[model samples]
Target: MRFIFSVLFFALMTFSLSAQGFNNGVSGEKTFTFFDKAGRNQATFFSTTPLEDINGTANGIDGTVSFDVTNIAKTIKGHVKVEVNSMQTGIDLRDSHLKSPNWLDAETHPEIRFELTGMKDVKSEADNKISGTATGNFTLHGVTKEISVPVTFIYLKESEDTKKRAPGDLLGVNSKFNVKLSDYGVQNDIIGNKVAENIEVTFNVVGTVK
Candidate 1:
């Protein structure tokens, strides 16, 4: 009877330890959408022609983020996909040219993707907000490049509004970064002088726990 009691005590301790380990981290998934009324996703480009700047936006951006709240820097993984065909530069002819084979090749490579690789310089701030620099592989026009993006995020526990809509933990993210078109094998001599090679991209995302 003494030996049986000892074995049961050991098993209970092991089970308790396992439970603690599991509860230490919070795992969740979120599907982020840009077409929502509250979301915004856009890119800006500079043009020497008329010395103006151009703005293009995509309304069909969608993606998913899988996050572990307890280990944010290491266990946060996400992928964002932009529908190239859905992008518009505010001009019909210019938009067509931008999506042509010589530019983004939207028909062939219909999606621009970014996969999160790591996070750095993470700082947890007040109000459940965290700021960091995220490194990721950006794929555009069939070329892949590593890029670093500065991001700010806030985590919200389930509230009245979230319970009515999201029903779980909510995360809000904002990030901005720059990319060069020439680096992605997109070059056109005729428009090169008119349009700048570097583009600025911005992301405003809201995610909910699965």
Candidate 2:
């Protein structure tokens, strides 16, 4: 009886700490921000350039991301997977155009992936916005590129949509990363694609706690 009580106590304590630093072991949806060419109109350009995918949480960043401060490193690494077909722009035509051979070519390679390399928490020089520089290898269109994106991570608690109830829940880190289409060899391949040379990709991801 005493041993069982001790086990319960330890479990409760671990959960409490996990809840406090949800960003550490918790996973959240990833949001991406694709940019447009320097010369383009954005008024009719609704954010249809949207995709739906989530990472495996801190594991998306690294296998061992402890909440403790001293153990923290200059960077955390993780893997992210995105379903290229789940993109929605509120406009079927635009979405289809994007998914067609002109842009994403989703039929051939239906997923976009990234592996986190390093993170630099700093304030941006352009807007003074506090951001972290997460450098990683992004594989798109069956091509991989090493890119650095500035992300602002805000950690939050689990949603009510959980099918299984747990004593504690996951951690959600809401973040956005932007990129240009031309940089990744998408523009030339896209036929008559009025799609801007700059394409913004975002992630709304959720990661399960370990």
Candidate 3:
């Protein structure tokens, strides 16, 4: 009777372990492109000028995201790169000045990039949407700073058509954050007067699983 009871207990433990084995794993890689048709990847800065607020946009934004659906916090990784010269503020002369040595120095630093380091305060929302604060390293003007960006993620399940073409899930992400221009050593007396010291950056990215 004791042997029979011991065998049953071992069988139950084995079943439990097997059931929990699929709880944590990494999902496939996904490539995300920043849709800039309507000036999506843009930065807005308020200044003392009465003319108008500066709106600089980038059309070249490309990145990748790897997510773990089971363990959302443990295996979320992403990196995005934007071309510095792609930024334009409408005025040709002003745009040229922005790319010159005094401002963003596009010739020196051609690319602005962000790499996700960690995430916190993650909350799952309705309709496959997830909200969280992502902490990452933002590099601009040859300087890197750690910034926390609030992001919303929406996961789209694979449909029959998607499976035929993309073969994986689609993930949409939106994020917004503010940064000080001085933090990246971007300070000039003339430009500072027109451009605000703080700049607001925003991102709307869509990713496809690999």
Clashes of each: 0, 25, 0
lDDT of 1 by residue, 1-210 (tens): 999999999998765433321232344434343334444544333343445677877756667676555456766678888888878877898788888898889999999999987787776664467788888999999999998999887777788986765566776778878788889998743244456667778877766665
lDDT: worst 10-residue window of model 2: 39-48
Task: List ranges where model 2 is wrong by over 4 Å.
Answer: 1-75, 122-131, 155-169, 188-193
Order of all candidates by TM-score, from best down to worst? 1, 3, 2
TM-scores for all predictions: 0.75, 0.54, 0.74
TM-score quality measure for candidate 3: 0.74
> Can you write out model 3's per-residue Cα lDDT over 43-146, one digit (the tens) per residue?
33334344456666666776776655644555667788888888777778877888888888999999888998777777656436777888889999999999
Tens-digit lDDT track of model 2 for 83-103? 567665555675677678767
Estimate the lDDT of model 3.
0.69
Residue 156 miss distance in model 1 (angstroms)? 2.1
Q: lDDT per prediction? A: 0.70, 0.47, 0.69
lDDT preference between candidates 2 and 3, better one: 3
